[model samples]
Target: MNHHKITSDHLQKKAYVYVRQSTLGQVLHHQESTDRQYALKDKALTLGWNEKEIRTLDRDLGMSGAQSEKREDFKTLLADVSLGEVGAVLALEASRLARSNTDWHRLIELCSLTGTLILDEDGVYDPADFNDGLLLGIKGTMSAAELHFLRGRLQGGKRNKAERGELRFPLPVGLCWDEAGGIVLDPDQEVQGAVWMVFRLFQETGSAYGVAHQFAAKGLKFPKRAYGGVWDGKLIWGHLTDSRVLSILKNPAYAGVYAFGRFRCVKEILQDGQIRQRVRKMPRDSWLVEIQNHHEGYTTWNEYLANQDQLERNRTQRPENILPQAAREGLALLQGLLVCGKCGRRLTVRYQGNGGIYPIYECNWRKREGRSKRSCMFLSCPPLDQAVAERVLAAVSPEQLQLALAAQDELLARDGSLRRQWEMRLQRAQYEADLAQRRYEQVDPDHRLVAASLEARWNKALAQVDEVRRQMEEFCRQQTRTFTEQQRQQILGLANDFPRLWRESATSAKDKKRMLRLLLEDITVERGADREVQLHVRWTGGACEDLTVTLPARIQDRLRYPAERIDEIRRLATEHTDAQIAALLNKRGQRSSRGKRFTGKMIGWIRYKHRIPAVELKRPDERTVAEVASRFGVSHGVVYYWIDRNILPARQQAANRPHWITLTDAKARELQDWVQSSKRIAKRSLKRQSA
Candidate 1:
């Protein structure tokens, strides 16, 4: 070791010993490396720096030398070096100072400016000297390269192991690595049951929240395996959350697949401009390695894929996917099933009547896109809902549908409120307590410390057993009602009569929605006339059908006169006066739909609405179509054809209404001439000519 560069000025200032390890595992097992770093204090003393001048910056002991962001001691060392307070920076190696070139070079520049000396196990160097500064620069560059290579090699090996399905990472709760180094379902049956329950619930409910809610509602606990500290490899029971359920559903390990590179390490800049490394989840398609059927698992890969699709549909924020969402409480029976035929977008439901009781299916795509001032259409919901619901119920017999509870009353193969989990939990506690007691009994009294520790462990284990028993008692107490055989029989009977069960007040709208989804895939609605809607229904069995439904009229339309009455008034007004029409209506015992008696004023109002003229006022030469046909000795069809072609002079009040034909004796003779001249004019002409 050379100390020729160490001057009195350098020996007078404080000496900093920078110590760091890349990880906590290295700090615990690599004690020799830590001892070597601290031994630099002795080197500083031998270099003529007194013990007081030697400051050990070992606070960075379990931290990385890659960057100085999280290492307080490293930052302090840099601060002291920049301020010329550090006469010498002693570390076991240049890498200890920094494995990042930027940090290392910055330290070198500061050391050169302060005229400080850099010391390591190799020797001492004056940063102010040209040759020494060059050597320090090369060493800093080499140290950075070494760190990069080291990381690459480690990561490469890890990826290699993962590709072969041999890599060992922390398994998700329901899985664990066995002594033989193969992935297997956790040996704890209780944990297995809980995990199975989550998958089962999600499958039945088609919702992550539904699974979690089932757990909470049943007063059940979920299992989590502790990864580190004293609780490592121990089962942790806690309340299940939707997020936990989602993790379980999403984990491929549960599906018996080994996957690696699910997450990538990324360096992020914080608000304070400090660099920190974090992990970001990668998409499944971006995963580096995947091995299916790696071991026995809770589910299959196909089921996992289905679960993923179900989750994607259930996720609220997935705007790209317009798949039907989980059934919710609403009056709109076709909530997610209705698609706008015009705009080809999902139609949303809007409630507008008093207390929002009336639901209207509205297509707000145009409005949402700022393309329209109002929604595209607002089809009344009740008519459509009832129409489709009746058809759906009628398509199949009562035996086809089986109304089911959203969640089973008993969880995990009907284990009854996690009774199996509690019993298993208590058994494990008792086993541990018994084992600890045996260990204490075997230990000699002379070794009081060992015996006392064993005794304490036994007592703690017994206490845990007691706690488990108490929790089980409380859970049992909370469950007041048990599902009975008669009740089960009633449910079966309802299944036989599905419509009655579906119409029951106890059946929720959400459940009904679920029931509807099972039979029907989707319904495309096209708004037709103001009084009707066209429905294009697609069933799950791949059959398609189109139906038209009559919509309920508006308040005003409902109060208006019936079409039959209007037609009757139009017929009577052509020849009869309003007074005469009223008299005839009364004589016939006819009245308004509202039970009002016929009156002249009412007859006049009906005439005005229908554009009916009173007493077909015509010249003496004019006659009705029937009269014109009779005068021509031809059929009314011939007279109508002549009127349509303007051949015969006629006057029509409106389309499809009565027309009055003008007939002079000369014009009637001309029409008779055409009927006698044309072969096609008479229906019996062909048969009569042949005879």
Candidate 2:
């Protein structure tokens, strides 16, 4: 028993008994093992150590000794031994201290230096002695090797059971054990319905987060199975979280497959110089066992694989640049589907205008890489979106009739859900009204105080019932007011008329954007010669369509005006003022070559540029304000109103003098008509207000 290892010097110092259990389950259920470890304190006292000198460390009771980092009690014991404070280190076995050589050897080295004795049920060993040290080293090595063998055997058993679809773990929501102890769908219809709804919605929306959002919007909760104690296996309802939805979606079990080893333990060194373990997901192919069609499930294995692919594609931050992302609720129809032909990079969408109604597609790849702005590819969204939409409509016209019928069915289904909600509200209100009336009738009329309150409550409840009834009637009326047979026929007739449908208020921008993403894989735009943009459309099936689209020229892009228009403008500048020239040019439909309507300022600019002389209006026949007003059969104020509004031109000789108005008979007639039109509008507005 190595009695020589125990010395008086060791008895003078404290004895540290390190106790641990590998798991919480063992700590709770394996009380005998814990008692055995703690009984080592009596062993230390039997070895001539006083009761006060014996200290038990059970802080690592629910922690694994396979790694030393998590064992704080073990660390404290080692520190005391290294500081020459712990004279004897006692444990139930070497494995209880550590199953790793790094930890065991370190503790042994510290004990050897501190002249501490190691004790267990077998015997006591002094690490300073060569024979005992060698034996303890063997014990430590064997302990670590035993752990490896035990783990391998357990893992092998698990894999075998999983391959046979017999291994059991915590089932996700909607699955539970049957009376016969076999896995089956949850007996609760609501739980089963919720689980099925999540899968159905994911199928419809092609997004896990979208499914959670749908549940939240509908005020529906997801069921989670409680794991332990009184609540074990019970269903707990909560608002569905995105991660929970994703977990459900990603689990192979939901697809009737038994899969194991989806995750692997990884060791990481933390900032505190300790090892940490994390469970990281492994690739599906790397899973140790996968048995398909193991049980009844919500989806097929093939559908599960498709869902995985879809989720991968839906990621906006994929490292690979080739994959397209899900459609965002942005104004740009081609937001995630556009690419720059010149740069071979994705184009970013920038929204402008009030409410971000206008979208601009720009390639900022080079700019992001710190290149000059000249490398950017820019295109206004309206023209490009129109061009692409026209092409898409042409490509999809054959299926438009089928899609229209399906859309009509979807609308009816949505209305059915809404109608059910209204009906529920109506029923609730009717019940309240009936209850209030019954309560009022039961009240004694002579007790006026209570009778009055009950009557008022009854009246309020009646009002609520009426409001709900009216709302239900309105809803029913709206449901009945669907598209007429003739309208349906017209819609069918114009199934291929996408332009008209796109412009219709019934079509949402979101639906349009989703439609574009579904049809087109990517559109590459490159600047071409002669103010044209070359659009290379890659359709979903790898079909490519190339089109040359003309970019609208800006006013500044016009090199010069036509020589004939220029000569007319110059001549008009000679006899007419700038204002008169503009009016005359506009009346003759002689707009600027840039397609802008001529204004007085534009006329002056052209006249000044060409060195044209200003016109002189000094003739006696030129009518002044009072003369013009008399001629127009209107007041002086009306004439002045027309002049102020630029309908007529007037000049002043001095601030105090009357304004001189020059008017041809045509001008005088236009003024009279404008004044009469304004009066009629004002009179009509007054009549409407009074009515």
Candidate 3:
């Protein structure tokens, strides 16, 4: 019969062997795989099993056994066991099958249902026995706990290392791992050169996207990924544009200092299958560890910081992809640098009509839908542009530079004098303070001396000292004058070179913005008749005075009003009763320059010019006779009689009276003549009465 050979009295059984590795560090040996099959086959043959019934599973190399669901051979083995295809299963250890309690329990359940026996190096386990099942469960539980404990211990060790600033993970781009230390520079300087090139390119193009595109087009390889390695725009741009990675280029850590735990994260899971909250960075002081001069550096700290500052300025001034073509052509030097003087808003360039012939800069904010209140008082003046450029160049010219350098020297000398004066004043104040303290200590406690006397004297001395200190501070502030003659010469050289440099050199939008700020102080544009325009340009050097155009009659009237009259108008407006005076003027056929009638709004304009505070007036009935007399410089009885007779006009009576009477030399002589004439008339009248 084709029955199995039964040497011993027990039934022979077929068994399968399964092997696995949990981590990349572990390797499967050919001998191990072959030996496992032979051992299981030998044991089965010894039990009188057929050779063909022996099956081995060894293809699942380097696969983890932590989760049964992920193990292919384990799943197949369980299925075969459940179908009763195998009577027994064998392995080197229980952990080799599964280190998770849940997975182990599932295996045990399958074995018991299929009546399959499990044999390990320790002993054979009969799943049918209650005691054996319990022992197996306990072993599985211990194994899983051991795995968890091992993981916890490993993580704890890593955290401790991080606290000591010795933790090492995968090195980021522009850095490499060192066997002696932890992270260091790449042995090849080519990568570092490339990194510098990237920074320089960013400083030139002002766009990370453009930089990445350029790099990719040039066939430069990006840093390799940890998994599935390939270079693409996203990866290239991600590394090139990452603020974190860029920060590393500017970080002092690689200069031989340890910096660790610069970031923290709060763990949170969202219902949408995403991690909502994570990796919140903390302050630098809160970092876990810090050590100075940790490794070799690719760039100096100053250069790195400068690059970072430049990058930030670029981010603010140049939006990504907005000026890609302009960047490529090196045009649009004034793209982000120009601003409208009238509206104090940024100006953007526009190309209109066919062939884009007309290029004009217009204020974006001034062109809003409802911005018709003022018909763009700002004018576009090309002469203003040329004038500004010329003035800037002239201001930085050799002679001008010499002047600036001289000015700087004068400022330095002034600063030194001021500093000495400040020191002297500070010393004097300290001495005074000390004297006050000593005097207070020397005073007799029993004497009935007024404390106010001492306080007054101390306050007076302190006030004097404070005055001197304030003068010194003001002197110091003034000491920050412009460059000296030599410095001005150097700056002039730079300024003279700027136009050419800006034209030829590859400068970023940020650089252009800085240049504009340094060179041009302000640009004022005025619209003339027939759409003609005039520009007033101001530059950094006080040498280039602001252009003063002959203003229109309307504007000139506002500017040239007599100071005294303006003050009077402001004072009257503040009295609030000036509204009646304004109404009187309106009634008298007088009107404002715009031919508009007077209103309360005009009061504000008048008051603002006069720099006077507004005041409320009392009701007419509340005006006392004394108060009316005081206002008009008349006797109370006279004021009352006038009020009773109603001789004076209501507006004149309500108006503020002059504080003091004044008579010029001519007016005084005229008054004397009038008095003499009146006396002669009086004498003639007396003679007639006598007759």
Candidate 4:
């Protein structure tokens, strides 16, 4: 290989000038680009090169030298040098040519192979010179190390500042850095006013999308983009919908707690061949810092929390398409009132199919389980046009209104009483608990007598406290029950008006199901044979009553009789324990007025039907005979005598076995009759009076 000896005179012979700035922050004027160009030209001339032969590389603005292969200007200049079109390469310094060791060495190797000379303001360094090349290598390594160190130092400083909560980034609107210098409220009232408007708008509209559209239509200018771009819907909506932006509005940070490090960014390589950034919330304990009274807050914490709850509710409610016009009008009243009868969940309204004509109110729980399961519950979707309007009209009736007012008053009074009672009981319980605690604390563990006494007292006090709390709860329920009848009347009045409203109201207005929900609780339709449909109307507050006021007398009669006969059978069953009496009645087979069979359920129903006196029943597991006797209001001797005498009926006697009874035939017959009659066969009535 024939190598040529390249010198400064052979290199400074290019015409092009390549100027570069590493970043937008680095101004070409500050670095004196013109001066550097002139100087490099002069140096080339000094090296016996003409001005026309001089070439300057200065087109690398907004470029970094971290990767030399990607620097377009550098690559072009190298190409010219390789073609021997350039005599020498001139720069202000070696660092300007390359800030990386690898790129520096590669340049040197190219220069040496292509017989190109390199010159800087400091000195001309020919690649052919062994000592000069070694010096250039050392300078290149130092340059690279300095760049690395600068980056490391910068990052370390940022991390330290962040840990101290002093690190500042872009303020996400509704906020500004403190004038004295920390995170603070924006001084511009206009911006703060806009923030307030966003919250108010959300509350009024009950929709983020609606609010965004309103702002867009009004041509509201979003906060000036920090990046110097015009704001569009994305920016406007982002500010309006951002959780952090809302957080700031709610945060006391404005009232002056500087909360920091609540979230962190994690970087990961995604399948799309790009690095993605994800944010994860940090725990409260891990928060970087919280300095109170940091700045003026735009809203109070309470107002902010309220706004958040409103936003959350809006998110959970039906979409615009699903919400009827009427519902939209009375949304406030019906927002959380309607509930599913089956799953005890809220029923959500939805529009089905393309035309959006098939409006339906469905239980989300049932829908999620699919159509088959939907039938398991009484699904009620009375047409929005008639049913809803009628229901609402009924709900707002004078009678209903009166009942509602009465119920509200009653409820308040009851609640007040309950609250007072609960407070009194709670105070007593707390006092007792305190006393027990103190006693427990005072008792020495080593002293059995003291410990035992304390334990017993503590147990007794706790038991009493529990009992009082239970009583308080029961009392509260009773207070609520006191208003139930009134609530029912109000509900009935509301439901009764629905049919009228359905007939008179406009179809468009009828689309408002939510309005119906405000007035009526539920309207269920049951399909029967012969194309007969039964409508059951349950008012908002009352027990469900069949609204089919014109039910066939026969059906009405049937319903009335089933319940009545069931009750009658239960009464008779309780009076008689005699299976024979039951059998005789079965043999006689007298049909109920409804012509339904009277079975064991009817005969023995009284045992389960009527509330038994607590004193009459023995607790299942009472081991002590005295306890059992006391529970039944019987003497212990009587209990023992019953056990020993086995005076139990034949069936019960069989259970007691040979140890208890030696029954004569006459005694057996008497016991049998008692069992049949469910009455004690009186000894006086018996022909043979044998003990």
* Candidate number achieving the greatest TM-score relative to the actual structure: 2
- Where does candidate 1 stray beyond 4 Å? 1-13, 46-51, 112-117, 123-134, 339-384, 394-502, 523-537, 541-691
Q: Which window of ten consecutive residues has the lowest lDDT sum in model 4?
A: 613-622
Q: For candidate 4, give the lDDT.
A: 0.58
Q: Residue 597, candidate 1: how far off, in angstroms?
A: 17
Error of 1 at 112 (Å): 4.6
What TM-score should be assigned to candidate 1? Answer: 0.60
Tens-place lDDT digits, model 3, residues 474-504: 7767677655468655666785687677556
Candidate 2 TM-score to native: 0.66
**After best superposition, candidate 2 residue 190: deviation in angstroms?**
2.4
Compared with the true structure, what per-residue lDDT tens digits does model 1 show for residues 1-691?
Answer: 3367777888789999888888889999999999898898988888799999999888887777888888898888888888889899998989888999989988889999999889888888888889999999999999999989999999999999999998899999888888989998778888889999998998888899999999999999998788889999888899999999888988999999999988899999899988989999999999999899989889999899999888886765432455677887897888888878877777777898689898888888778779888887888887888888888767654343332331334332454647777888889988998999899999999999998899899999999989999998887776435557687567556555778768889999899999998888788888788677899999986779998999877877766888887888888887887778899999999886467888888888888877877776667767899887665566688788898898989986545557888777787677777877887765544454556
Question: What is the per-residue lDDT of model 4 for residues 643-663, given as tens digits with 9 covering 90 to 100?
Answer: 566663222312322222234
Per-model CA lDDT versus the true structure: 0.83, 0.81, 0.60, 0.58
In candidate 3, stretches whose alpha carbon ends up further than 4 angstroms from where it belongs are 1-14, 23-25, 28-38, 44-49, 67-70, 78-87, 106-117, 123-134, 152-292, 300-484, 489-691
CA lDDT, candidate 2, residue 505:
92
lDDT leader:
1
